[model samples]
Target: MEAQARAILEKHHDNFLEDGNAVPAPARRVVGNFNVDDAKPVARRFRSIRPEHLRKAYDQLEKLFQTELIEYSHSEWASPIVIRMKKNGGDIRTCIDYRIAIQLIKLTHYPLPLIDDLLIGFESVLWVLSLAMAKRLWAVPMTLWAKHISVLICLLRHFQWTKMLLGLKNAPPICQQMLVNCLWSFVRLPASEAAQMDVDGLAFLGIDVGDSAEEDLSTLIEGMTVFGRNVPSSPQLNSVRGERPYICDIGYGTETWEQLCVDLDRRLYRLRYWGTSVSLLKNKFGKKRFSHEIEADRIQAQSKIAEGVIDLPSPSTLRDVQPFLASLNYYDEFIESLPVIAAVLNKLTDEQIRSGRDLGRAMEALRILKRKTVSTPLLRGPDSQKSFVIIIHANPWAACTVLGQESDGVFIPVHITGRVLHDHKFRYHPAENEVVALIRALRVFRAMLAGTKLIKVYNRYSMLKWICTSRSLEGRCRQLAVCFWKFARFSWMTMVWPQSWELRLPPPRDKLDQNDDNIIQVTGRVIQSPPVRLETLGPRCEGWLMSFDGHAKKSDRWGSAGCILWELLSWDVVQARGSHFADVTVNEAEYHGMIEGSKMALVRGISEMVIVGDSRIAIQQARGLIQCLKPRLRMLLSEFEDQRQEFKSIELVPVKRGFNAAANYLASKI
Candidate 1:
């Protein structure tokens, strides 16, 4: 493979392979194209030339000349060239500062494959022993007109590339399109190639570019695509991979099925954990449950160190270090300490080529990462009906977060993550760090936590709002405050002390200060599992009771809302408000009436009141039992929260429609 790569480099180093034939790109094929937004031609003078590196810059120009990659040009468009030394100090790189030129570039955008979609399902589990990338873009020829955009001003001499080169923003999508076309034209076996199979079955084909007919490494078909036992039930992309076991009908495919099942289960578990409204699938999931604690011995078999996967003997360059880090990054959400364990490798990313090569330290970090990946505990699936618990821990070096949920009687982890602090982050106040950690975790787990219940412990829920309102803060804190606005609805909450707490538990059959069979059955398993509520207490004001209801005709866009505030002792109405709405949902009308009732209470200077409503969803949201996620409802809830501050104590009570007839009649009469 190495010899084939060297041969390709020597022969067609500046050529792209043709899709039709197994030969070098025959002509100047402009796969990627761009147009200037305006008629003006952009030009800039050469800059950033160092006195000590002048000779190396000239040597780089000479190398490009010999490779025929660049030629003299008289184009009006010119980007300045900057010179920098290579990490080894033996060579120099001539780079272009294309900032100004990029302004006029009419961006040609194509949808590159998303990393999330690529890292999901069957593709992520495949074993890849070796992977290499050759400079295939060099073969993509530049059009005569487009070549002007590539012109660079070096020492007042303008030059342009005859082939595709770095610094062009549109090169990636163009190269992707060309490679896709080439693969589509490659020789492919029939999907049902049952008759073409040899008696000994099939062997995976490993292909090399620029290979001859006499070579054993040549696939003859021109390229290699990893084939599996059976097509996945879900949609999949054709990704290149090394040799893996294939399935045959002769009872030999059990291993492949077993491995696939494990991988598929792991993926589904994560999807469930990350989803906001996941429900338990009775038929798909068995009665099995994960332990509250993670045990290394119980991890799945596939997680163990596979033969060739984590064999990081020695990686001398950042290029070598990056791919392995990317492979481990797939386990980021699964392993909490990933950022900490790989801190040294992450620290090594910006190091010079050979100057900071700590092979021993890097290898040790990689080895630890391998073990961490294997020992990661399985996460509990999310339940939309249950609330989510977020426990955040911050130290000097890192911030860790754990997403907790309850199943049956025990609490289990849904997801775990850690973010290492470096540079400016280390200078934050301790409380500031905690807020940073909280907001970061909230954003990452928004998919699961949004529109779900969160524990409103103390004033922590309002911390974000406080930060946003604060006047004394640095630019970083202000930036975080700006980002916090995007997630304001997802994190809004408040708290109530235990004295004001109201809970309804099952009545015990027998109790003598002991957990009798029928009495003490309630096991206080998960601490935050109970559904606690609050009610108005320890307050002396007008005993006001507010009942609200909304009415809408069948299939009508108009509605009416009514609210009545009456003295609880006399049962006499003190004030009543009715409003009609157009093009509003029933829930919206109900909220309108609820808001009207609160306003009336505030006008009467009522410090404590009980609010009753018939709409269950709006009532729950007002009582903090559920989240208000809809834009309109969220706005109404915010307005209600603002008005709620005027009262010393308040409670939202829900009643059946039949029992709220007084308010209903008032609404329908409007």
Candidate 2:
């Protein structure tokens, strides 16, 4: 240990717990505040117990009194007491079940730390320290009202807990919240040490000296004193080896053994400075790896993820999809096609475009992503000091980018990423798509390229010139141009034609059909599907909007159909009509309403029309994207198709029902 650290530890000797129970947290806290939802609390009936166990309960209660952990209580909220033998089988433990009390208390939600993030921090380190705390739950105290509900009755005498206990649902998250608050300042200690040890601290960081007041020591000291008795202790590290866990059994590594000793000393010194002690028996220093380090046996963790060892199931709804992706994101660096898969998920997550036009395509993309994520070749770590080369591909659906560096005259990949495009982006000219892809790649990999200059970009169809010279940018395109120019200025970038064979990575396959393909197999980067173009209207009713709606009851097979068409030039209804259909389904009625409305336009010699309807099935079928499976529906679609030909130009649009209220009102009145 360093002399300074040793002096600090010796100065706060009282905080250290050499043996017996742990010293309480530096301050008292109301941890498990059991706020009841009801005015009166229900006292649960006592559960029957064996005579011998009842005697153990009484003995435990007397010990609680001696320890001042419990006191005589006068409250209607009573809970049944239960006695159980400790794991050692040497002593009995007593506590109230509090099952009913917990139901009455309002729930609290606080996020716990993630294990994958914890493990990723241990990548190149050679040494790690695992520390534990004794009786951590006592770190957060309970309010007086909380104590009233925690009553335990040993037949005659009633008692309540004076300190916080773990029986309530909110206890764990409350403890987590407190732990995060206390450790908020500790993550910067290494940087503080780096500034002193290195010749230039802020040179690489791109910042000036940090404020001394913002640096927190309590985080490190308090962190070493967590992982209380409630968290199972592992005397032998080998015994507790497993996959990732919720609480950090921290094994973050340093590059060398000497660095480990220094970090250990720093922690010890800080813990003593904060008036806390480390349980020598619970901490393990200089360990190879702990339960969470995927790097120790990366293949094992990779196989586990591929084998579905991660706790994820097929999502049944659109809202469940993002979290499912997030669950797999911890290991995304190891997945070759992360950006492409994320793009597919983004389509499902968007609420505005629920047109149901590309549902099957999204599902297929998700499958391709899953199959591609099975394994990947190891990638070189990114070096911020060096310039970077990016190979990019983009289409209407998704964009893929590969970031790499030239090492020993060979192209070495640092990272791969992909993302789905949104509304206006999809309609962008092919050249604009490339510009969008480039802008997204720059933002995604900005961390690795922080200080890098002279970025080299390559694409199948180079759009660097288009981005530079195009003064016709509009809306989304203009925003993308501003972003691109900023990055261009920052990096002094140049665009070059790509030599695909020079890089080791396989080109994205033309079709994403095979399951075992190593690279992200996006559909051909060629613009396979162009954005929908409204049919060109002739002289009559040239710029007009049409709203159509249909009402039908399955029981009676009777409904009314209506449509209203207005000229955009005059804001007046050129045509409005409603008719009843006695023997048609809802889909048929909706199509008939649209067809009747179109006929009125044809009679009025209106050659062009834009039709909007709430029925997705009707609009999709009219456009021939959805095949008609039923014969009656086929005939109605054919009639609608014929009516479509009469107009010089026609456009079919689908929208939510609430937006088509005017047409719907006319339909229901008929």
Best prediction by TM-score: 1
> What do the candidate models score in CA lDDT, each in turn?
0.56, 0.61
Model 1 weakest lDDT span, ten residues long: 245-254
Tens-digit per-residue lDDT, 1-670, candidate 2: 3564455445435555555543355322224567776548766556556676777777756766886778999988787766666646656776666655665677776667666456765656656667554455654556788889888866847788777677876777775554442233223222343244232223423323354443454564433323221222122111112222233233445677666665554444333322233555566656665333256455333455466733345455566677767766665655555655555556453443244554554566566556655545557888777778886656555676778887766667788777666545656776777676677788888777765666777665647567566777546556765665644343323334245634555443343224222223343222232333333333453487788888898899998899998886665887788999898878888988888888888878888778888887888777765567775676566557656755789878777778688899999998
Worst-scoring 10-residue span by lDDT in model 2? 229-238
**What clash pairs does model 1 have?**
15-139, 16-139
Deviation (Å) of 179 in candidate 2: 1.8
What tens-digit string does per-residue lDDT give for candidate 1 at 196-291? 323222222222223223234334432332121112211122332211211100001112434434332322222111110111211121111221
CA shift of 610, model 1, Å: 72
